[model samples]
Target: MSKQLIIDFVSEITPQLIESKDGKYKFRGIFQRADVKNGNGRIYPKKVLEKAVAKYQKLIQEGRALGMIEHPPDGKTRLDEAAIKVTSLTMNDKGEVIGEAEVLVGTPKGEILKNLIDNGVKFGISSRGSGTLIKRADGTVVVGEDYEFLAFDVVYDPSTPGAFPETIKESREDKPMELTLETLKKDYPELVEAIKKEAKEELRQEFEERVIEAIEQKVSKIREEVKEELLSDPEIAGAKVAVEGILDILKPFISEGIAGEHLEELKEEIKNLKESLKKKEDEIKHLKEELERKEIALYIEQKLSESPDGDKIREAGILKEAKSKEQVDKLIQEFEESIRKTINEDKEPKGKGVNESRQKLSLSEIHRKLGLPVIGG
Candidate 1:
């Protein structure tokens, strides 16, 4: 099974914009580089980079190296938003893979992403790949050799902002140190405090909303219970019957006499009528089952009379033993077939009587009976 990994890095864009005649804003940037310890404390080894480079080159050659912005890195969710494409990839002197990509400003999402990039919104590129990771004891991970490079997506919500610099420095020492949450608080305490305040307020609002929802659910349940109790009360039931009786007596006198208050009584009467109908239906079903059973018994009796071995079958108590019409029919069929087989066996002829005659007399007895002497005596 292949695992997924997202490689987040800053794009190193050139100053000059490559203008196009088709009203698309095009810019060049190195989307990712290999052999560097990224924000996740992981490195893509040379072998892994080579595999990715080869796969990406094939994709570009087939014009299928399309990518998107802010999409899921796992490729679980699909959106038809191809905002970027890898143009070329090459390995530098330090065995690092460098790649250039073009952003298509023709798409709606691409146009928005382009506008953000132009306004210095500070986004990074994340390369999505399916592979296995080998974690070392030093807490650094390396991508496996069987890695498949999928797409480089533009990510706006990077975990560490300083990991992606707007400008690429010649040396690692020249780049700013990777920022931690603790380090960020120490550097910008006021901004950290504002974020905390906002988070607390948001949590408080969520808790309040949950409490209100729970209370509303409880209130609705209580109201339903109260309504059911009232409906079942003896006093309420008597009053409803009395009101219905009065309405029935006055219905003929008044033209539009049935008021809103009588609707409840009407509903109760309808409920009672439905209950009566349901009971009648159940009774009808039971009667139908009884009729079917009697019909099956009649069929079994008729078939038993027509059976050839009816006397033997009746003596064996097969009719009483059979619980259903199917069992009775099976027994009848078996008995009739036995009778037919016995009749067929009796009609078959016996063999010749030559052995029987020879056994009846010895050789000397046969000669005396025929008035002749025995030859071998």
Candidate 2:
């Protein structure tokens, strides 16, 4: 026969602590503890649970972390039997699997669990999983490293020693829920600020990226459409010569020379055409040079304005390369990216990475995440 449902009941959620901080039915408690012998005469080592908790973190983030009202009928987490949305699960320095799960009050099993929390009925955290057991010489059973943490089932009876939440909730008894922003403000003000800061920064960055992406898509489409419309005159991008017709008219005539009186007329015409062509060529050259110079100057301004490394860049030969308009266009695309990035960096709040280490989610984020909204911060 397969292993019986291994329900390691660790703590009881007493009615006295049934306070929902923001109408979100949530609970904070230790699901399973390490190195603590329970009433079942079983001990779970820290190393064993550490690996399990680390593996189980994926489920929590995916919103698949679930629990049953009493216990799971089988090993797999069934959607029909699921009653809790296990959001935040982590191990503290004490080697305890600290967790915060929201009761799924919408489903049938959830309704039952909600009624239990509402009526002040006692419930406890029971971690369900399968693992090998080690029998010590003293007859004490230790949960081995093969332990696979499945889900946290909130139950009524706990078999672990001091399994009551009063033991686990010793530090957080006065608080409603740990993930709530209010509680975070009091306990970890810096982390709370970090959440707000990082949330805004990320949202802004995401919005900017999305907005820029959308604009770029639209611009690209319009650009393609314009290119198609101008396909007949690809040279429209360059200067339009009003006297171009004169060149077309004179070309055939110039190819065939005239004799008699028309010969003198043709010679004068050739002389005049040469001067006109030279003047036009010089004019076009000057305009092109002027445009290219401006582009190069603008490129240099944008590059140097970003940092005080103009001398270094010149010494490195990066800026000494061809400063033509075509090269400037590529440089504008490459180095000007810093302009947008700098603007975003300016909008970023101070102490940005302070909350990066913690895996715990915030209550609003949990609710926003639709739970423990990964819903949390």
> Would you list the C-alpha lDDT of every candidate in the order shown?
0.60, 0.62
Clashing residue pair totals per candidate (backbone < 3 A)? 0, 12
Model 1 scores what on Cα lDDT? 0.60
Best by lDDT: 2
- Best model number under TM-score: 2
Error of 1 at 191 (Å): 42
In order of appearance, the predictions have TM-scores of 0.38, 0.39
Native RMSD of candidate 2 (Å): 21.8
Evaluate model 1: give its TM-score.
0.38
- 10 residues in a row with least lDDT, candidate 2: 166-175
